[model samples]
Target: MICPRCAASLTAKQRNGRMCAQCGKRFALDPAVHGKGMHDIRIRGIAERATDHGRLKITLTQLWYLSRSRNYAWAGRDPQGVPARIRWLVALPVAAALVACAVLTGGVLAVLAGAAACACVVVASSMRHRPGQSPHAQIIPAEQTFRDLMNGSWSAVYGGLPEGVVDDARPVPRPRGANRSGASVPVSPPKAAILCTDRVVALFLTANGIPARLEAVLVEVADADGTKGRPTVLAAALSAIAQYRSGLPVVVLHDADPQGALLAPLIRGAQPDRVVVDAGLPVSAARNRLGVVRLVRHDRLADAEQLRTVAGLPEADAEWLGEGFWSPLAAVTPRVLESIVVRAVERALAAPRPTHHEALTHGFLTWPQAPRSPRTSRAPGTRPPGTGTYKKKGTSSA
Candidate 1:
């Protein structure tokens, strides 16, 4: 294994886990934490996407699982055959209610009763509460947001990736009516970096939130061209370096794979002069912290070339990644992905507002300053009686 610190090869003769003969740095990946026992971890490598903590709106992946976990018309094509047990919980009751209503409540009442029972069953199925588990973090309805972000409209009939979804590769086409303004508007340079590892992710990120004619704050590195070390990445790398030189923070959103891990490093290599914080795939960072990678049976696994690319990872992590399967960055639902992007932007913007001098010397990040309106302040150019602001309506005091 090459030293992550020095990038030098290591001989396999060390007996102590702490010893590294090349760099001689004793970095222990795993450290025991005190729990009920001498506890090490609650989650070792990510379990095979196997149901962890969560609640509410789902990702495309989550929807796939939820569909498979039950047997119903809506359970999708569960080719794996949902366990019969799931039916007893929902379908069985609905069916029983239908039969009972047919016997007791003759007329349209029978159908209504059955429909009511089905609705109740659906609600019951969705109310997932288990001991020691937090409800899945609520997100803006994942399926809807993704659909809207992709097509810039939430009118999708279903919560799935639709064909011809607009993305970085396919931006919202300018309407024929858009030329009504006559002359073209000059394009503005992006103010911040929102790096995404894939085209879909970049499209979704750009498409999410208020639809704008132009996205001035978002500079995208939609690594859509597949290979990481391509001329496209070099273009993105150069742009990122340019942005870094201009004092804008680069926020990278990547998959939790070896290439994803390499993104920040690659950009950092592009501009060794400036500092760029890797707002990371924290799990990947966690893996680096412990020198381990979690293996999961993701519905989507990395292709052979991707797997081979990460194959040079340290033995333990490479084993975890190479265990015949892998997950995509899409494993992070659209909602969570949005939250991560927002936080990264917030962190960058939160850095002390640079002074004019700093703007000239260190370069400046452009951000609109917020208005400082006191709670009692009236709307600008509006003033009424007593308190130097508009008086409350229907109040005795002026």
Candidate 2:
């Protein structure tokens, strides 16, 4: 292969990480595509057509174990034997109900009637909660505005954290030891940093009524704080899990579309402790039910296709689609903004606004006028106590 940018011959690259030597620009190439030259005889076979051709395949034994032992279904295949699984599942309760009813009603007729009722309940519950039911078949429940604000829209709601999610943010306190004799010592107050994208997420916590006292506000503000530096804006959202009661309810409110689907999981993955209630439109009648609904965009939104795509999202993807969905250039329709405002106000009513009001107020971040003080002759990077930058009378001049 040749480097597209620099027109230099591309050499064999490392696993999954490709490079453009001459231009120093790198593009990830399919791992399967490497070493298999386009002109190679192997190119004439089925390998060229496979979507996963770049991925290496494991042994059949491993595949079987993943499928059966762990009860995992491999990608690209609908779950097999779902009907049988459902019927078998439905049968257990049906039989139990029939036996119980017979004893209660004192006859075979009673047993048959009870069996019918049990069958109905089993069928309804299984269909409602079954794993394999296509997402399209699911009905979304209405949401309340207050609930949406309190719980947050789906993509923003709390949920499970991936392993090592908060490892980087964990505070590492300095050790205690002897000091005056030139020995190690313990640090006071213990410094720690809570990484976040900006003050927005932190503010969101306060808006939802969580305290911002030193308790959760340690230090640092960034999108991420981890071994791998993926840019994001919700490092401390995990703390919201403890602030809000566990598993009360969470609604993911976000733009509906592909990007939204991908973003919601990132937030959910960071907080493994809380349960995400749902992802969907958070209008007042949508709470307590499946909360998946399309966001109402603002008027004259430039990206009609994007807006349309988001609004047209299927219901089953409420969770996957609601995470981190942001489009800066897109104009949200007035209707959408109104809906958002309504939901937010409703939620705010549910709980008193979280602590740290200054954080939520934008002007708090506006640069403060320099404190007035006398001029000093100190050189750059050196200033005596109480030296201020602003002008004041009766101070030494340079």
Candidate 3:
């Protein structure tokens, strides 16, 4: 809790009456409000918005366990019971005095005895004891029970999460230059890549073998002059700087919302010839029809109007988003989404087919399919219709 007067951290010890150390003012805390709730109302509100309260709460509880487990193994500021120099300071003087005394008496053994005794005592006491817990230990474990309550909420929402996504979600250190799953990015850049708006979705896709990066999907890309049509976004911004100048096929995957609906246009601008596919979130029908487990929020996004104006969403889909509702990208499982994205890129890179529309598109024009030779396509005994094989004036036959 913050001090109403000066915003310093207030503790339970000073709950009733406390003085603000910074401003030197006294204030009272409300027992009913401060640090009091089954779950913090702010978080609970976000969780309950999509009828996913129980599941999110359980995740919060798992988060709590991970946090508390960290507390149990946390280290302290001070790491020694006493100063290490104290023992040396005490013994060095005593050893010097004994050697001085022995010099006056002309005794060699006495000097050696004093030096050895001092050395023994110094070695024994010089090792400082390990430090204890921090002064904040009193409040560190206070939320243990809250975590328990969250765990007991009985939510099955994790079924929608991709395997290993939740485990990797925990904030633990990974090897430098490696991603959350301890895998370094491939040396050869993928032929094409997938970009996601949310960091969580990016991490999930990257962990599951879809070459992806954490790139935000904005509702619209603003210009240097802050204009709409001349907008700039990640892929488009990179292209202007000659990044995807070779025309790399960029696939965009995002949540179902106004901001996501306009993601492709934002990346490709008015009209682009690149193989950038806007494989954004599916419509409500497609999501349900495909049995995609995603969380739908009956709320509005800040950029709802921008999407309706210029996103070019099909009529039925635009109507749904205009009514103010959305879904999180995590609603689609990582494996499911990854498979879809990989297949989309593969088809884009696959052999030219009879359909041939996309086969000729997306930078495959230069690498045209080889034309078949006359010998290869014809049967062994057959020849072109106009050329009869080895004519010899009817071969002087019959």
Candidate 4:
């Protein structure tokens, strides 16, 4: 391992006690003591990339995923086969026993030993033929393990977390409605709301003041128990915000999974009068894409039929999701995720505001019209066609 302070290659004896003999500087993390690729320098590089070179802030959970290798193991796949050296060790011993038995006793014992040796050889050959299905199954460390390493070794050595990394486990401060004197304070309604499925993603946005910058409210769909089912609480919050402002738009951000794909459509169905834009991690972006971390969960298998019917997803995407493959939005680099959310919110705010009936009928299919050239003359109290309907008191027009 290279010393983080001096960049000198240090052997185990030289770096004993976590002190670099060359530079005489103590380092926080040793690749040999921790895991491979877990040195301080490597962590700093990953942190820099995850935060876009200090342009954005990322949560500890996001940094953890960023530190992991891109290779992932799918569920239900066969584990890696036994090594050939171990197989040979067992086979050689069995063959020697069989030969000794044949030379010492030409009876049932020799036949039994020969059968045992043949069975051992056959099993070893079969196992050798079976290729390892998932060698990197245990590559990603458990969350708790990573947290302990970071909080213990990393913190002891570095004094704190790397730059631009915030602990998501800490409590986030919510907006207060009352003043210190106990007087009620009036607050203006937000222009839009960003509904996020992941708590860490919400924390990332809120910690970075993305919501305040956009004058938007951040609503996390997941509950305290981390359940990602129907977001009744989020729906009610959106309804309340919409009541405050009649046409408040909603931007939905979610993972690239079956439930995530359906989240936006479900919101649009519940809030038929508002424009709900889905800025989720699409399956297309994760499928077969390098450097994207894909995870599998057998307990939460996707229903292809449900995704196809509710989300109107393509057959290929639906099938891929149905197989229990999912990519987390938090796994995306912090800068990229922030950009995606910002662009989606802008689009939601700019979406055309149609009547309730038009919204229900046309939905997101409605596009904003191009600016029309100014007209020289028009009839009194009249507007151009396709602009909007105008009505006078006690009068109706078709």
Candidate 5:
């Protein structure tokens, strides 16, 4: 491990107290104390990459995935089998015991003992190991374990979390007069909305001011009950926004699981008049992608069956979901995730507004003509053209 404070390679002895012997500077996250590959320098590097060098803010969940040792699925056969050496060790002991018995006992007794020993050796040599049970298998650490390391040890040593990394597990304080039902109160009426299935992703966007920059409301969908009912808060907000600003577009950002696959369709079904863009993590994006975390849950078999009903879901993706595979949006790097969302919002805004009898139509034909430049003189007989200003939205645009 290299000392984060001094840039000097540190031996276990030198970093025994989490202090560098060279500069005598203290640092958090000794690899020995935390899991392998979790030194302070590596943690900082992961945070930097995840946050795009402080240009974006990421949540602890994103940091956890970025810091994982293995992000892709295990290929080929399971690597948890007992070693040949261990099998040989067991076999050798049994063989030696059998040889001793054969030498000490009479003919029939000796033969039976030898046969039993041979069977024992065969069984030992053929012992099958369970998947993910090997000591060498790179299991993902539990979220709580990673959180404890970051919040407890790392904070105690470094004073706080790394820059641009927010702890999503911590409860956000509700503003005064906030709704008790967990619906977020928008500071102002929004032109668009981002509906995220995961609270962590929503929190990441909110922390980084993505919603504010897009002039969009951020709505986090709570875990669904079996009823599969539409979220009333989302419905009310959309209705109210549409009354003031017609054709309010929505961007649905979600994971690559069955529930996520169903979210966009559910919203579209409930609000057929609104434009809902699905900017979610698809199964194809994470299926064979390098360095993306693909998790498995055996309990999602029923959920996978339900995904077949979702419109436009590929058969392969449906089968993958049926097999209980999922990938969280939080697993995406902060910069890339932000880019995807911004592009999706642009698409939503560019989509033609839903037509209503009372609403005035706005399109290429009906758009206002460009105004003459201030420097250009207007004809005396012609009325002054309307002064139209056009501003292009960028990633940093407010």
Candidate 6:
């Protein structure tokens, strides 16, 4: 057992004297015990914490193993000085002397004599070897065990990390001089062309052999200043029309709502006559008819009576109805959207082309559907200020 005072190993004589050899600390055994139950109480507490006290004590013994392992591997500072570098100091001089002696006397005997001298020098050097001044001995195997323990513990800790916690969410790189998807695309076509605001609508038209471009301008205006009984949103609708008349007629595929009406003028330029067509018209009448209509609306507003009669539909149904038309859907429904798209295309095909600015500006009138802030609808893939309520899902709130 190690001495409690100096932590030094106790000798037989030292134990007999009940004192530490290194520190000279005295020890005594208690003569009067508190009670026999004291040992039982201590044993009970120890048993509650551990299945086997001997096992626990043996584990605690590893502290010595750890320290000893470290001691053998690590060199402690020397109290005095480091061991002298004897190998180089002695070997070189001896080798040089032996070589010189061999060179001076060239013969078998002289070479034999040099060889003997070299052997003697090696032996003498080995005899004069000085022990290192460092107090600790190298602990090789023990240090290795400690290192293994540390590595295993760290491995266990690292293996316990949760998956998908840290992702490298880098932005996708687009190609140079191309659209965001990296596809080479043409700019908007002429005013006489049949264009669309939604890509899906354009794709559908293109598939059906219609000459349609996506995101084509339907309107352009100087400003959004106040103008009579119409809501402020009418300006955007008028703008869509102006854009259309400047070149091609457009097919606006949007939600069946007030704001969705803005897209109509954008597709077909405003005409001198405010003529609007719908799917209710005979296919022959709508077909090849060169005019514009707010076709996507569930109901049209011809006057204040019509305007007051209009109301928003169920969000689910509105979205479901929106899907019948082709690409870039702001709505989600699958009913009658195709027919509405076809009617718009037929009307646009039949409309007369605008040649003058006045003609382009003529029948232009704004119908307020949903008054999206100019800021909110600046461009796709952008979030404008105060546009939070209208998300990709297409629901609006105060």
Compare the candidates by TM-score and give the number of the best one: 4
lDDT of 5 by residue, 96-134 (tens): 898789889988989988898888788886787654521
- The top-ranked prediction according to lDDT is 4
Candidate 5 runs further than 4 Å off: 71-139, 172-188, 224-246, 301-306, 354-398
Which digits, one per residue and each the tens of the lDDT, describe model 6 over residues 1-398?
45545567766666554545788855332112211211212322332333232222111112212222112112223243323465556666777777788878888967886897788567655554435443222332343443343233322533411121111122222222334432223355432333233333333333222232332222222122212212433454455455343334544444233333333342223343433322111211111122211122222223323223332223433332232211113121112334444445455545554444422111111212222322554457864332222223311100
Clashes of 2: 43
Residue 353's lDDT in candidate 1: 41
The Cα error of candidate 5 at residue 180, in Å, is: 9.9
The Cα local distance difference test for each model comes to: 0.39, 0.30, 0.43, 0.68, 0.66, 0.33
Sorted on lDDT, best first, the list reads 4, 5, 3, 1, 6, 2
* Steric clash pairs (candidate 3): 294-331
Model 5: lDDT equals 0.66
> Model 4's lDDT to the true fold?
0.68
Candidate 5 TM-score over all chains jointly: 0.65
Per-residue lDDT for 198-283 in model 4, tens only? 77888788767777667777766654443444455446545544554557787777788777777677667766777877777867
Order by TM-score, highest first: 4, 5, 3, 1, 6, 2
Off by over 4 Å in 3: 1-169, 172-184, 212-242, 284-309, 350-398
Q: By the TM-score metric, which is better: model 3 or model 6?
A: 3
What does candidate 2 score on TM?
0.19
Cα error, residue 113 of model 5, in Å, equals 28
The window of 10 residues in a row where model 5 has the poorest summed lDDT is 357-366
TM-score of 6: 0.23
